[model samples]
Target: MASGNMTRQPSPPRVFVDVDVQRDFCDETGALYVKGSPNALFRRLTEHAVARGIPIVGSVDSHAWDAWEFGSNDMPAPEGGKPGFPDHCVKGTPGWLKVEGTLPPRFRFIPNVPHAPIDTAVRELATGQTHGVYFEKEVYSLFANSVAEGFLRELSAALGGAPEFVVYGVATDYCVRAAALGLVQRGYRTTLLTDAVAGITEAGVAAALGEMQAAGVALTTASAVLG
Candidate 1:
């Protein structure tokens, strides 16, 4: 079952990738809890994929103590983890683990695999030679860090030279949307798994979908992504 807007281009293998599904992103006790996050349904969707022997790629929203960069449209940097939202997944803490319910026993966790090294992982994933890349990001989108030439080149390679990409994750408008559009600009076929994502606010969720469509990122449901 191909998800999102099925591209005419060849399938890039069954890479079941999840972005920032960490305590700081998808968990209810996360630093910045989205409105409907920690959603049971989203977890179930992931569980379904993993149970089917799909190579699961789980991303954690990892951050260093002093790693505050720019802020998202909605979430600003915390005075500390406590002051902003909730004390949460600092790098190397228990809170940094993936959201429990969505994970499978076979799900592989890759921490801070610098974007430079992602190309080989992506090639292996595309060839069904390995599980997909478990991508992490400190801020919004993984692609936002364009200055890293190594990362940029790797991303270009992972996208399989396609004109569009499909993405889904926590905080749709802020993080997920940024990643999707970023891929779009990089000339990848872009889409969003609408039902699988949640936002920190109702307005943000609506805004994300609207903007995604406006930017030519197809809006789709989990069924589309998973089926």
Candidate 2:
């Protein structure tokens, strides 16, 4: 028996965090394509989320022509001066665009700028007017965008609680790993869809999985998640 005055509590949010699933990483002809990555699986995940009305948060590597991370540049690499990567995902390029079906019809792109205002971003997302929210990043981690953390925090509060993040995307060893670990570190319950992600090498993927598992990120497959 229920009391007439009793009210139901709002359910905690569950969001899908799509990490760097752009043409450069997932398509065969792109500059930095990850060979043997299950790109179709990425599309399936996105479709499922849209059908279920789950919020989709994503990141894109929006680099410049002479960005320091490019191997063509003489500037030091982001990771301890190591050699940089081949040119890929340059701003306004075809390869920088999100793969077909991964982007929602109603989406907002958050630029990577210092001290960007987050109030409007949070309101737009929390109000259900925007189905997808994307963060343009200059580095492997979306956290590199100054407003990302603040936007997420405020979005969580607006939605009543922190989200349980379902993460999947390209290059399991890099952006996916960073996003998963960062979410967990920021007190979100994060889960990685293993089968849906593609990596540069088997060794790198295995190492990344181990590291993610050690840091309390749960791992599963697309089949498990979508089913």
Per-residue lDDT over 143-189 for candidate 1, one digit per residue giving the tens place of the 0 to 100 score? 53333234334544554543234466687877777777776665556
The digit string of per-residue lDDT tens for model 2 on 27-107 reads 889999998768788788877766666678899999889888788878776567644789999989999998887887778
How much is 52 displaced in model 2, in angstroms? 1.7
lDDT of 2 at 141: 90
Off by over 4 Å in 2: 1-10, 78-82
The number of residue pairs in model 1 that clash at the backbone is 13
In terms of TM-score, how similar is model 1 to the real structure? Answer: 0.69
What's the distance in Å from true for residue 160, model 1? 5.9
Going through the candidates in order, what is the number of backbone clashes in each? 13, 0
Model 2 lDDT-worst window of ten: 1-10
Tell me the TM-score of model 2.
0.91
In terms of lDDT, model 2 sits at 0.83
Enumerate residue pairs that collide in model 2.
none
